[model samples]
Target: MSPTQNIVLITGANQGIGYAVAEQLLKHENYFILLGSRNAENGIKAAAKLDPSGKSVEPITIDVTDDASIQQAADQIASKYGHIDVLINNAGNNNEFTHYWKQQESKEEIKLDLAALRQIYREAYDVNLFGAAITTEAFIPLLKKANAKPARIVFVSSHTGSIGLRTDPSSEFYERMSRPSFPAYRSSKTAMNMLTLHYAAMFKEQGWKVNASCPNLTKSAFTRFSDLGRSPAESAVNIVRLANLPENGETGQYLDENGIVAW
Candidate 1:
């Protein structure tokens, strides 16, 4: 690693917007990309393919649902780099990509299998929301070890998690949506946004950049039947932009593709 090399760890980076963020960040000569995936083989394969030049990408196994895995990864990074420049909590779950509307009526009228819902919620919340929080706790020591200033931590969230947008009748996504009763995914991300705020407040006392980002409704497998709008490459822009910001960047704010979202 160069003296000025910056290490960036991105979770759930085997595919989708996570992969795109890794790909885009590699253009910078100073970045050492840590591709975090539950599958070690997939992470290695993605690292090899995305960073064929081999100087940028480094694959690391990280199953966010597993506390042991998170601790192991954090320990390795802290031992190797002494500090992490950026941490992108990009991993999320969407209820096995089930079409909630097709399965049931409204969130209130739906009669989902309690066991199934709990199972999905356990994995999704453990990984999507709590995973970020645990990772932040484990890595804060390394972040504070910086020689000069504090580092950046980004939570890759979605607009579907936004309370303001979800409740707004006049908004563009009022009736055409199908987000019925599946509180696991949406609620997990809502918790993620709050987790972002909590971390941001903690880091603000130490002068670090920690914020949440709703990457918008990007074209991905997560969208299910929705029209493909923005590519993962495009969606990665908001996050990487946040990741690469200078020390003066915003913190504790929820941002979409355009600007801040009302909490």
Candidate 2:
């Protein structure tokens, strides 16, 4: 790897917005991406497709839910590159419970299966919130070794998680507060926002750029592969933009395609 090349690690990069982010970042010759995925075969296949000559991207197996896997991946990166310029925590979970409290069903006073609801909450929190926190913890040493002045850390979050917008009557997502939907998934991301803030504050003195990015209804597996939403490529625009923040770029801000998402 070139000494000047910036190393970027993007988790859950085998498909969806994460894959698109890798694709977009590859446009810049200065970037060297670690395409992180839980499945080694998937990661290898993705890296091969993204960097056929095996020059820019490396596939690494990293299961955010597994502490050992996270630690192993971090150790590997620390050994290979000594530092990481960017860490994009894109791996997440949104399960059956997320869609259980359907808008139509709520009118019938329908109820979610209590056991399943709790199960999904556990799953969502495990991957979305705890996973990110632990991954960041494992990677702090590598990030501190960064060649760049200020390392960039981005959390792939949802604007629907914003309490500020959820409370505003005029806001597009205000209705979400009335209708019970995605409680497990949304709350996990809401907690992730706080996690982002705390990390930002902790690293503020070192000028680390720790922020959240909302893809905003992107067409990906996360959205059940919706056709109406924007493509993963379009959704990745702001995330890659955040991942590539400059030395003096803004920090602790929640950003989306339009910029400056409400807390």
Candidate 3:
């Protein structure tokens, strides 16, 4: 590996937006991309598809929700690269949507099942909130060893997490976004935004850039692979741009495809 090459690790990179970002990053001559997937087989497949030459891109098994898996991945990266120039926390769960939709059926008047709701919330938070937090924490020491002037950490957030947009009646996302009804997934993302802020603040003095970004309803597995929204490749444009930002670039802001998104 070149000493000047940028080492970037992206979680949940086996498919969808994470995969798209990995593809886009290959255009850069200086990046050595680590394609992280929960399953080792899937990670190998993705890495092979992305780089058949078996150079520049490599697969890393990382299940954010599992502490041992996350630590093992971190250890491997640290041993090989010493530090990571970029960390993209892209793994998330939205299983609550399926559960909620199913409950809506076979009932005259919809009722909330507190027990089921709590379970849903816990599952969503496990991957979206706690997983991302723990993954970032485990990689912090490796990030601090970066050869790059300022290491970067990006949380893949959503507009549904924006309190300002969800509360404003005139906002385009107020009614269109499904967050208001899906408390589990929505609240977990909101918590992710907070985590982004706290990390950005904690690493600001070191010139690290940490921020959150909303892909704006991209068509992916998360959206049932529907064709209603932008393509994963299109959604990755801004994320790739943010990932390549200079050491002096902005941090701790919620951004979309256009620009700053309301928090």
Error of 3 at 207 (Å): 1.0
Model 1, 13-48: lDDT tens digits are 999899999988887436888999999999999999
Deviating ranges (above 4 Å) for candidate 3: 100-113
Candidate 1: C-alpha RMSD to true structure equals: 3.2
- Give lDDT tens digits, candidate 2, residues 1-263: 67888999999999999999999999954899999999999999999999998888999999999999999999999888899999999998878533653644566755558886688788999999999999999999999998877798999999878888887888776786546667778889999999999999999999999999988887787766767688999989999988888878989999897879788
Stretches of candidate 1 off by over 4 Å are 99-111, 176-181, 224-227
Give the alpha carbon lDDT tens digit for every residue of 1-263 in model 3.
57777899999999999999999988954888999999999999999999998778999999998999999999998888789999999998988767655666657655658887788888899999999999999999998988887889999999988888887888777787634477778889999999999999999999898989899888888877767878999888878877887977999989987889888
Candidate 2 C-alpha error for residue 107, in Å: 14
Which runs of model 2 end up more than 4 angstroms from their true locations? 97-112, 176-178
The window of 10 residues in a row where model 1 has the poorest summed lDDT is 173-182
Pick the TM-score winner.
3
TM-score of each: 0.89, 0.93, 0.94
Residue-pair clashes per candidate: 1, 0, 0
